[model samples]
Target: MLEGDERTGAGPKGALFCPSELRIARGERPSMIGTLDLLGRPAILIDQNGFVAAVNDNASKLFDDDLSVKGRRLFAADAQSRLRLDRLITQVRFLSGKPGRSTLQTVVTRSQRRPIVIDAIVQDWESAGDPLLPDMGALLILTDLNEIPRVSQSSVMEIFGLTPAQARLASLLVEGKSLEEIAFYMNISSGTARNHLKAVFLRTGTRRQAELVSLLSRLL
Candidate 1:
């Protein structure tokens, strides 16, 4: 049995804890909103009823004028964006009631032709809490694929057999970095870093940094 505000129970399959109860336990009243902001990723926190309880600043910026987005339906901002988001929500709900992991990715092009890609992962949040809320929801992460630095497809296909991780590193290289910096962050030696770049250039057929950056930007 639960004791002294300690609510315990089984939740949806994917998430083991109740996000709403967790929020409440953390001092967020049932009516309040909460949010967390992460660098390079936009996130939102929703109430049990699927309302936009809290949204990070990054999410707010996507609305054009950067107005507050709380109290709105989680996907009410744009019709197209809403449709895409609604699918994600449905997936989250399904995964909550069932078992296993799920990930969804979709690209959205605004009316102005600006493109944005969102990658979302749904999982169970388990905790001892109220039975009214589902133990599963979603943790959505947004990335602007258009902003990704690019290299020639041939170069990307050739050098280091670029995995997604390697591609991200290559993109960072276009932003300009010393071998030492890359080595320190990537946990590789300066020699390895040079080798990586050498492979990248050879595959892309670009001899200069400027050329590589310019080429990759267009490709992305």
Candidate 2:
């Protein structure tokens, strides 16, 4: 059994796929939320009863603004965003014991800012207190688009052998900058921005923006 987890057995695995780098070794106390914080992301953990169990340090910045935790429950300031958040929670709360998709994704939009991307992953609390997930029923990983990603453009260029312009474009996309906005910021015409984007796609082997964002986020 995981250290200090004698009360609960290991569940199969949470829906959130933890990379090898994020995993703790045997005999170590695993901190899933802590791992996410190391990468400069926010983690909101909920229990089987649909109550907010815990949140990491990075998550504190989100409170009283884009999101709020009231009565140990998480909520979005926007009505539509709150509805989507509630739906995701319900699905994750009941995801197990039923054959369904292993992962789900949704966007939590802010009133006057870029939307927050959410990935809701379910864990079996009955068998959970394992090292990986502890007592958490579900893990909500949030990527706020309004904030620029911590990834470095030089690293992207070196990893993918992309041109400086292409790497900048990738960084811009992750920053929630639209194509038009990116073109304006870079002082390039829209067509040129499209060309740079296509080049980045070929270099990174990512055909879509979301795919690129997911891949780049892992780099952090």
Candidate 3:
């Protein structure tokens, strides 16, 4: 949540675009820091100046020996990934609006066995409509190979507004299952499975199975 003093620092010109929720002083505490820790996901918040504002416990452990992130520059990671993070941060800072939100998929070598694939989402703290609080910065939500990603049937249905049958079909499609195989597993006829796929496509606004797969992959 960016608000208060942070917004004033941007001066009047920048304040014009300040989100409505940030216009008034509510003295809200930074709640996301605690929430991230509870979720046990590695996430960090950095100011536009590229300094780490806060880090969750998981992030501290993930980069335990490699880099000390809090209050330091994000470049402490590695040469290649540092460059990628630098660009991501710059992109968010310059864009500074809902349209400025973006995601970058990059790999970081934190071990000798294999590199960790990181999906970094850089977005402004605009949901609460405040960018003026002290140390209010954009978020860098990182998910790596070590994390177990489970997308439940209900989650897909709620996210895409799909019915239970449609959600099951879409999740199967994301797993690269064939239409016939899906029908067999669900104990339905191939035609019924195809019909569910059609409904999934319409609900997700995707014409092809590949497009539907891509959409669900991102959401999950």
Clashing residue pair totals per candidate (backbone < 3 A): 11, 0, 9
When sorted by lDDT, best at the front, the candidate numbers are 2, 3, 1
List model 1 lDDT by residue over 179-204, tens digit each: 57877888888787787777767766
TM-score of each: 0.45, 0.57, 0.47
State the lDDT of candidate 3 residue by residue for 82-172, as single tens digits. Answer: 6766676676566434445566565665644345555555555565455443344466666556554445789898888988888888878
CA-RMSD of model 3: 11.5
Higher TM-score: candidate 1 or 3? 3
- Candidate 3 stretches with Cα past 4 Å from truth are 1-29, 33-42, 47-51, 57-78, 83-133, 136-138, 143-152, 155-163, 175-192, 202-206, 214-220
Model 2 off-target regions past 4 Å? 1-30, 96-101, 125-134, 157-220
Residues 1-220 of candidate 2: C-alpha lDDT, one tens digit per residue: 1112222312222211121222223544237777887877788777755677566667656655567665567767788888887887777677743433356677877877888888877756446445544445677788777776666889999999988888888888887789999999999999999999999888888899899888987876
Q: Largest TM-score belongs to which candidate?
A: 2
**Alpha carbon lDDT at 168, candidate 1:** 52
lDDT of each: 0.52, 0.69, 0.61
* Residue pairs in clash, model 3: 2-130, 2-131, 2-132, 3-131, 3-132, 3-133, 4-132, 6-132, 7-132
Q: By TM-score, highest first, what's the ranking? A: 2, 3, 1
